[model samples]
Target: MKRYKSILTVVAIAILGIAAGAGIKVYSILHTKSADILDAIESSIDSGSAQYAELKEQGRFNILIMGEDDVEGSRRSDTVLFATVDIDDKNMRILSLPRDTRVQIPGHGVQKLNHAFAYGGPDLLKATVEKYLGQPILYYVVIDYNSFPAVVDILGGVEINVEKRMRYVDRAGKLDINIQPGLQTMDGKTALHYVRFRKDALGDIGRVHRQQQFIKALLKKVYDPRILPKIPELTAQMMKLFKTDISPALAIQLAGFAQNELGRERIFFSTLHGQAATVNNLSYWIGDTKAANEFLNAPLEMLISGDVAENRNTNNFAGLSLSYSSAADENGNGKASGTEKKPGQVMKKDELLDLVRSMPESIAVLNGSGKAGLSGEIATRLQKIGIEVVMSANAKHFDYKSSNIVYPINAKPEVVETAKILGKLLDIPSSLIRSNNQAFYPSVIIGHDNQKLMSRIDKLIEISTQ
Candidate 1:
């Protein structure tokens, strides 16, 4: 009970803890020097209206949360979380969508999820997330990290169990982070250092765990009664630190309902099931792109009241294990009247990998093995995923024994994993996967033992559901 699904929300709430409680804590601000913060809270309460009456009449809603750094320009959301809170069941489920996950933006083809934020702000990011999850999100809250250091310092400091020694220096960030491994208390500045230190092998993903740790520590402090009298001071520093659509009226109204109607609520946290892969030599997290609504996103009940129990995920909130249904949709109904698999071998549909879209931007393929038409044959299969083979010519000398990828530039911005995934589909070996930035795409050299790989793909594609 009383769990925070994401550190962004926890920080926003803790920084402005008392304001979130509506005016119930307004009286406690009388003794503090934070009169300015009290004024802002009073103003919000005064300007608020009962817009959540209908939501209260029912019992659940979903929120889309975006968390970003406090930097000035070229801002991209660092965090994207989808939360579903069902007051009726006293349960909350949260799904954290990684910023680097591949998604199809409205005007942009498949790109990193965070690009939506940079391209169109939260609204576009929301739309992109909705498409990925197979649903829509109406509520949102954005946490600004600029004033976060102040909040931690105001509460004296927060404690964290540093898993390992972190030492990273970034002159541009004016960041020189060096914290030893141990259980210790970190001041505001040091706490920022701890959260932003993402130098482990895990990369950005590792930073997520650090953020979670900080939230746990911050939550412990929020629960401490000593912060009660100083709520106004914290709220003052935080009132302008966040952006949300939550009206003061709805916040207070929901607060009362959450405390009374929903007692000892249960909260669940989950993230997308995927792995970090190099796409075109660039790093990205990729997963099954065709996951259905039930498996990928929150149910409609998450954003509205009077939702059916089925949509609340009451029986299936244990974790992120997803089971596929060949014939059923999220509502336990057929996908469509004529959508069932036709009972036949659909010709021209025999491919192990479906090219997501026929993107023709910056991808290439070549035949390093001199067998005539070998390059064209492989390009056909690659096209299924919507990849138009940019270069399908033979290598300078066609005396190679295997196929591999090459990146002419540094691997930092190359799409490396695309070749690996294609290799799996094409039954290419990992040893054949090279990382020389010599070619734009992968070079496929036909080997004498390539027949076995084709047989495997043929078997997979020929299998019929009917």
Candidate 2:
């Protein structure tokens, strides 16, 4: 995905639609944007809302934008953040929730809050979040990571200063990536990695900060005059990659609103304050519920009354739900290695092709419910390696009844072997594996680790360009 900054910059350009007096369409954008609102109040804590809670009462508005990269029916929200823009104050505050933060997930009961989205999509995630913070969500925006590269590319590219020297390799999959610490110009792929890396000690929180910083860098790109001619291309790319309840007319109006009320200097960013804690024997990122409430409800009260403060939200276990499945580690013997493991392996294009060729029969690439793509990227890759690739529209949709990534059941040994190669190469245990067979009722799943690989790849590409 594009750096959050560039994406937001494009979003800001699109917001012009919302700002314009675009009539009902504009109103629809206001209505459909799903904000993660507090669903139920906690009995132990005093009930209140976000910094901008007051703004709502005063006729101001706030909206939450969430991005998820679900492949199958499995839903796992990738980016969750609250965007509070005070029209009156002309101040916008962005508070991001760490995906791994522990919290009470609505309806499904408390677990890692990110699972709320995986189990029920955005609506349930919003409800769970609202309940967590004791506030009402106003609106929402959801999209996938695939849309990211095009969006970033459309804007030319984003500029961000690197903080550290970064490098990693995935040999089995024939993958290697690196990034230098310094002022750097990142294309779509590199920008995507900038926002996705969270493997460091800081965890998700660190990732969120990187996201915010990149937004500033991306905004500079948006404000550049050079991007004006690319408007049509950018809009088209966004439509292809994005699916939102926000109306087309409203989008134009938002663009207008941004041009008028929103300003770079006026925006503020923050997150909820808390530390990881264990609740009911389940590990959770515990915050001073009172302080959390104060931080949230207080600023929100101002926003709704028309005021705005700051923002702020993993684990692996198996046999619980498809949403929480961990990658398989250890040897094929099914032993628990207790080491941090990646869910699947990566293989070189050539290596993967050989594995497929060795299979007894030609396999078909199937969409959910057994559909197929005529000339898809996967098929092209296969063909390059001398394997006959067939696109199957009749491919069974097994694993991802709820999410997006579909994992085949009893995956071909060759596929597993290929992934193992990738796992060994990347140094992360390979837990994810897919097959061309239309069988194996697998759950749809997209691993968080893929984001890391994507970043590593972008870094490598960046170095090559240099």
Candidate 3:
């Protein structure tokens, strides 16, 4: 039997449910004593935007339903779908960002937007996305694969209209997720893969359509009155598996209107229209800037509240570590809750530091003893372009090796390309590289656009360089 890989690590899909945990329970118990938490939250930050509050007080309320792909070990959002709910108007908007969609990477320059997560994790991803949209991302939600099964079980089952016969093998074991392409119900595992399968030649766009379909179905499951009492359990599960800036009180308040808002029939779903293009000799999913700006604004301005608006201007961002779910340690035990068991779990200390020292803020070169003076020559070449260098011996353990750099969850394509160059320079064979990891770069070689894109990724880099 062919060994199965952990599907959770690949898709990072999240299920819709309640958010709760020990922290939540303890807080909730204490909250009964006084209105301290709620009061604090209100005073600390504005939950509702002044504009949104004005509209709601005038009987207009809007909510942006965001679905984030928080795979195990990595909290960075993978798939970002905006669901806009206008309570007073009874309309909704669903916008999907193709994971491969190319966008500005803040300080780095221009690159695939998904890399924002791998480079700096969630904070960078959120910032880059928020800036691109030109609106506040009011409420944020995160969910992962492991918690998905429990959520489906909690709700008895979620009905999904499966598109094709899903016969793929995953770490959850073999999934015979076969169903006709029509109205149908799905259990946890089946539904999970149903929303994640991107085998079609269209690549990530195929995944986008599947995600849109699941959201429509999930809203239906959430609204049925029969699932009302299960809210506490769902919330608890959410706390264990998800994180967001959305506070407990606000979350509860939002739940109150969930059914009425989500039950509407008129919902809009569209992926940003764009064509694949190779700029500076590197591939990118480029779209019309004007169209993207227009498409994102109407809903973003409406649903995103005030606190998030204020955060949009700040440099505060959160960090997340991602590894395969089945990754094992030296003793063959699983690495962590979210890590997958995979061989050659590269030591981040030495290799990561090597890359950092060589490139610092930009790309770098690495050399093993076998390569002799090659590292020096490459370092000299990089120096001509104002890049730095770190020798194998002088390099600290903090340096990431080709593997870790290449497979970083949510990492940018440029970083991956950097790894490929080091690999080729050191004469490392392709077979030695593990392609099954979450962040594998198809090739290690670098292109001029890759470097330019990396430069645009992080705004902080520009400030530091200046």
Candidate 4:
């Protein structure tokens, strides 16, 4: 239900529910007594130039809509969609970005896209999407679902065609979703159940499609002229759910659309095209950059600066990790409700070679066995398998019996995993993996066992590459 509430939050999200009447900012309906709620929405940040030349040049205003799954007090973004609000055409384009889409997060290794929200909140999420889509996102709305079901109830009941019967009970979420097949009128809870169900074959991909469908159904109810009399109630429901940086003028423009000739046809849907691959035995979707851009009709350069997101890569030896911080508002104002957790997950090399490539690691090889050129030879071998050789030199001593990988305490997730993989490849003892917090690189000191390690390294490189 937390995720469902989150979805309701994201449903305003992209839906055009009107703002409040009289003189008031759009998101000012909060009734919280807590100082924290007041702090979270008290953003005085100027979103953009009064108007953006990019919007005029590109013919669309990009808005990011994200919904968090507050399950177990974990705040990973459960739903992420880029809403391209085209002003000139008076249309909408929502591209549902998969939560698992492999993309680079600034200051972190390449991992799932949705982790951005969990780590840095909406600001980071906007930045990540802008980089991925190569566009400017001028506004966003994050809903807290405490009073969300009320919004659905106020709209009467949304008419939806059930694809099939759905029956699921989740104790953790305290959700009981059981509905028979065919056309139905779903109340707030039932509607939430319908949209949040994902036990079927297509999994998340299918759920994304269902979200788009639920949105259209919800919009149809919103467009009904009967809603005119209930404008006050509707406005309050919307205001309470949304948290955004949208300018008042843009909000008004969006509200004006309901009184215009806008229809469901104007809203198009898109999602990232990618394949599922295992990284460290964890499932992540390797996004198809070309396909994502093509679907959106906007190239990367058109949306992001320098036309790139640096942390993302399409190469072998690229390490991976999801950096989801504990529950907290991206803004410093909101505190996480849960206890502290570890920085990232431990990745294990999967048994299959079909696994996706990882982010790169800086590897420095040093000869310690009085071998004059062994370091350079080993460096060349490592490079063939995608581990970059940043430095190659002789060790201070020449009497070491075995080589080992050294990682720093402050090493990034990718570096740690890379060192472990390298250790395994070299048959380095677990005890030999030194935690050198001050080390600049993941250093490898070649010992007298170089010949034996090299023999294994050569075979490992051949297998890793092909």
CA lDDT of each prediction against the hidden true structure: 0.53, 0.47, 0.43, 0.58
Per-residue lDDT of 383 in model 3 = 51
Candidate 4, overall lDDT? Answer: 0.58
What's the lDDT for residue 205 in model 1?
63
Error of 1 at 433 (Å): 54
Summarize candidate 2's per-residue lDDT along 1-466 as a digit string, tens digits. 1112222222544322322223324444433321211111122123364424444343244455677764454557767876654443334556566676677775666678678778877677777777776666655567677678777877777777777865656566343447678887888888777787665656666666667666667665665555666665765676666555444444444455555444453444444456656667766555444544443333221322111222322111121100100012101111112223334444455554444445444444333322233224334443444545444343332222211222243456654454443333233322223322233332222222334533433433333334
TM-scores of the candidates are 0.52, 0.52, 0.48, 0.54
lDDT of 3: 0.43
10 residues in a row with least lDDT, candidate 3: 319-328
Per-residue C-alpha lDDT of model 3 across residues 28-136, encoded as one tens digit per residue: 4322311232243345445466534534342232223334455554544457654444433333455667666677888888778778877866556666776776544
lDDT of 4 by residue, 170-196 (tens): 987898889898888888888777767
Better of 1 and 4 by lDDT: 4
Tell me how far candidate 2 lies from the true structure as C-alpha RMSD in angstroms. Answer: 26.8
Question: Candidate 1: deviation at residue 23, Å?
Answer: 8.1
